[model samples]
Target chain A: MKRVLIAAALSTTALTATSAAAQTEIEFWHDKTGRLGELLKEQVATFNGMQSDYVVVESQKGNYSEVLNAGIAAFRAGEQPDILLVFEVGTATMMAAEGAIKPVYEVMAEAGADFDADGFIGAVKGYYTTNDGQMLSMPYNSSTPVLWVNRDKLQEAGINPDVDLSTWQNVGDVLDQLKAAGVDCPMTTAWQSWVHLENLSAYHDVPFATKENGFSGTDTELAFNGPVQVQHISTMGEWARDGKFIYAGRRNEGGANFRGGDCALFTESSAGYAGINAEAKFEFEVRPLPYWEGVDGAPMNTIIGGASLWVLAGQTDEEYKGVAEFLNFLSSPEIQAKWHQDTGYLPITSAAGDLTREQGFYDENPGTDIAVIQMTANQPTANSKGLRLGSFDQIRGIIDEELEAVWSGDKTAQAALDSAAERGNALLRRFEQATR
Target chain B: MEKRVRFKGLWLPLLLVMPQLLITAVFFFYPAGQAIWQSLFIPDPFGLSMRYVGLGNFEFLLSDPFYRASFVTTAVFSILVTLVSMGVALYLAVLADRLIKGSGTYRTLLIWPYAVAPAVAGVLWLFMFNTRVGVVTWYLGVLGYDWNHVLNQGEAMGLVVVASAWGRISYNFLFFLAGLQAIPRSVIEAAAIDGARFWTRFRTIVFPLLSPTTFFLLVVNIVYAFFETFGVIHTITSGGPQQATTILVYKVYADGFVGQDLGSSAAQSVILLVIVGILTIIQFKYIERRVHY
Candidate 1:
């Protein structure tokens, strides 16, 4: 009699819990912590409030590289999340992951949503697309390199506050003046290889690698050791020697110095505005990335950084449908515009940009539009589209090591670039061979 | 009589050892075997397909200049870490052994650092010596020494070595202390009464008796330096300033996790396994021969 009573009570509890669990759950793995993490949670809450059929569970999964590692390990264990956020550099690896990911275009089409591929900005969309221009992933947070100037520091150094810094020559003159005026850190840059070499090559309309920067073929060779690249790197090396440029660690380690008002000029992602706006007590300004005037096609559009959302395979059709709906909700003009204005990421769509402009957000935030203009100023050339090389993350490490050598005055700029290119080519060949 | 208790039946003995054998196979042999197997093939990122390239990965690693440089760096790093940690620990143990009161308090205080994780220790040291805003760096600057490890290869290497050794000193200290306490006090007293000074007593009697402990520690410290210092290097220098601190293990991690070159990383792991095996064998052989000393 007692056992039967307990069994009846357990069954009743089970039924109540089942009824409460009606909503399907979708797992989202992202690489945003702190402010971005809170924004992501807010978006998830809004989506959940708007729906009764699904609940999206967002989890912070470390930084970009760590998150990618987690996703790969999870996929290997057959326990991957429904959605994975991958940085721009990992696009080729994800694309080559045949039978692993479901293309975004197909998901939208299957869900019967009014999806327009052309709605996204061309430069942002081109980075994660197939050869025929089919979208592979949804652009989540797009950013481009820009010049960040501490106006207070510049003025303290007795330099003109409105000195034209649109060209490298002008920036050089300013750097000399800052050095002469006893500025400790005249210029420091985050992601030196990205801001100094990669974007520099793109803005000069020079190829960083052959075969359209590996978008057309995997058998591409690094051409970043060309005379234009050599000239720019050697100039930076000279600046480093003269204490006009500070050699910070790789990957945004210099952000602290720049935002702390110790640096007069910083070349970093436009996304830095969110952090700078929150922490910087000094006046700062965002300006266009300077171009080298000697190049024929100087001031070309810069490539994109940040990450995109990929739809992993091996999920139920219902889950995919839910993912499609959630993505559509995220890309809505109001949400995209709010995310752009709040986080300093580029508005992924033209409609979102238009909405943000119509709301007069650009007028209030003057330098926020610099990243968009820098990315969309011209139709992307073959050189400026973006890199799609396999094993590019590893190649970036090699480049970083060589760049550090140059900064330390251990190797000549030309020698370092030549070595970096040679080393990078070996990895590229290995990648090509493996993929084939 | 040989102190041996033979099992009545062989089945009982076999059954008694089965659990341990199963655990060793499951935890150690299985992963090692898998690494060896994977080292011979290159797989796609998704691992949907694999292509066999026998010994190709090993060849590539052997030919890579950075990998070769990492081997030299690892050797230098392990030697420095083992020497520094063991040397400091021996000194501390000797001082504590001489104390008659408050010895337990000293031991307790010294063992506290062992409880801190190696990665956390690395971070602590990095905070003190960071080039831009570190307290130590600022003091050095005031003394006319501009310390910048980001550009200085020697400074970067020294920082990682110190960070790695600092966390290990506590562990080595415990072993050395125990070894010192295990020595019979009578032998030291006789040496002292026979007109020998403190240094003479330690050299003739105490040092000879402690040879076994030192030998054991040599092997243990070498292994600790080789395998356990990755966290310290990762946290502090990240093998930076021209790969000056990039040891073998750090290279393996960078290639496998960051680079996603699984075959190369696997081959590197296999090489490390063989290296460890050889090192253990050499230690055993040498220690056995030197036991009579």
Candidate 2:
């Protein structure tokens, strides 16, 4: 009797929900919550309202990493979503997978969707593009690293809040002054491995890894233990030992330190704009990430972060078309422009950047366009482009471990980096063998 | 009569037992067996990579430096947290027993943390230890303690221990409270009247009765600290200002999922399983005997 009643209730619930309506439903799963998640929902709602022939249902799967995991797990179970949002680090891993994903360009072309390949910003597009210019994933919220200055703290430290901080040498001097001025937390950072080793390598025009940072081939090895990376790490170690640079835990724990107005200076993502704007009562400024003084091409553009939307394989053609329409809508210049202006992630397209500029938004905000400028300042070198190695996420954990040792005064900068490269490369070999 | 007995007793019992055995085989044994197989064969989840590595993965783990550190950290954390929480839980349980009127109310509030998800517990403890915005940090600063986990190793260790303990305190409270309630009050009262002080009373009177509960909690708290505390550790520390907090499970997650290094991750998982298994055996062989009933 109970089982029969449960079956009747389930049928009633299903009838109340869908009523067997045929609207070509497409599942769009993401990892954004809070303001970002709300924004995503709003976009989906707009798309859904614009048409009756198709329904684009966007759902919050989890956080960035969790969503990726869920996507992969679902794909294995043959229940993958039509669209999946993936962060930059997972790009190489996804790309390395043979049949788990369908390239975005193919999906766009298959749907006969109106997509101008040239419309995407080169830096943003290049990260997700193949060697022959085939787009792999749609860039949704790409951000580059920049120095976040708590202007109030610097001013209180008796230093000029607007002083040029484009070079590490100058930043070091300023840190010393801040320390002398009784600032306990002069500097902290988010994504130390990224900002320190990654953009650090790019800014200096040096390779972080061979085989084009694992893009051209899986046989890539860590080149970060070379002189440039070692020097930067050693300098940071010196600062850490001197109490000038506080070592917050991995991820963005130090972001709290920065946003709380305790830390005088921070190196973090440009997309941190929303949080800092909301929580901080102190004056803050965004500047280009500091590069080492005297390095050739020391101020080259940094790589992109944030995340992108990936259309998974194993979906029906009609669902693929909906995904295409959704991607195209998301790519529209007005949509892109407004998203960039509001969220502080880079405008993914040239037209969006132009629109943002024409609206006088960049000029009005002063530092709002700095992320764009830093990313598009110069042609990217082999080193300046994004890393795309299999097992990169594991490799980053190894890097985190080594970097921590340096912070704790257990190992010197060179030693820590040497250990990281050696350990990271062994995993690289294992990954290479697996992929081969 | 024989046919009736076979149909009623043996066949019916077999039918009733089938579902549980099937579930165990499918859910638990299946994945574990696959992990062991995958570790030896070294198949990438991506399907683009597969290799016969044999025991190469294990050999790599044995030689890895961070492997040693993670194993040590997990062992140390599990051992210390189990001992500390057990002691604290027993003490609190005795105190609750003394409160004849408000015992239920105290028990309810005491096990409140048990209702919180591990991730939530981690976040709450993180709020307390946040160097910039934390209540504990403010007090620690006032007391002139070096309280920054981001900069200090000792402080980082303290933060991990605090977070680990807070997450399990709820379960411990529940377990200990139940054990104390089951203990007959006449024994404790007799010891008290025989001129026993609080400590002496606890040692000679109520202690023997609570042994079974203590045994259960010892195993439980050990498993929790080893397996369950990773959520808190991952969120609060991500294992360090350096690698100070990277335990076995953290490395496993980082390697298998984050790094997408399936082989190495599997090896790490195997090691974790072995360690926990050994601990379980030790508890059963050595500790279970002490239980009074």
Name the runs in model 2 displaced over 4 angstroms. Answer: A1-23, A51-53, B1-23, B46-50, B98-101, B167-170, B173-210, B289-293
DockQ of candidate 1 is 0.74
DockQ metric for all predictions = 0.74, 0.49
Per-residue lDDT over B132-169 for candidate 1, one digit per residue giving the tens place of the 0 to 100 score: 88999999999999999888999998898888888788
User: lDDT per model, in order?
Assistant: 0.89, 0.83
Model 1 misplacement above 4 A: A1-22, B1-13
* Model 1, span A1-436: residue lDDT tens: 2243355557778765454366667889999998899998999999999988887888888989888888888888888888999999898888888688999999989989788889999899999888798999999999999999999998998888899999989999999999999999999999888888889989999999999999999999999999999999999999999999998898788999998888999999999989999989999999999998879998899999999999998888888888999999999999999999999999999999999999999999888899999999999999998889888888888899999999888899999999999999998888886778
Per-prediction backbone clash count: 0, 5
For model 2, residues A1-436, the per-residue Cα lDDT tens digits are 2243355557767664353254667788888889888887888888888987678778887787788888887887777888889988888877777688889999999999999988988888988988788999999999988999999998898999989898999999999999999998999999888889988888888999998887788888899988888988998988998989987766777888899888999998999998898999898999999888888888887998878888888778988888899899999988899888888899999999999999999889999998998898988878887888767777777888788888777888888888899988988887777766
Fnat values, one per model, are 0.74, 0.68
iRMS values for every prediction: 1.2, 2.2
Question: How far does residue A303 in candidate 2 sit from its true spot (Å)?
Answer: 1.0
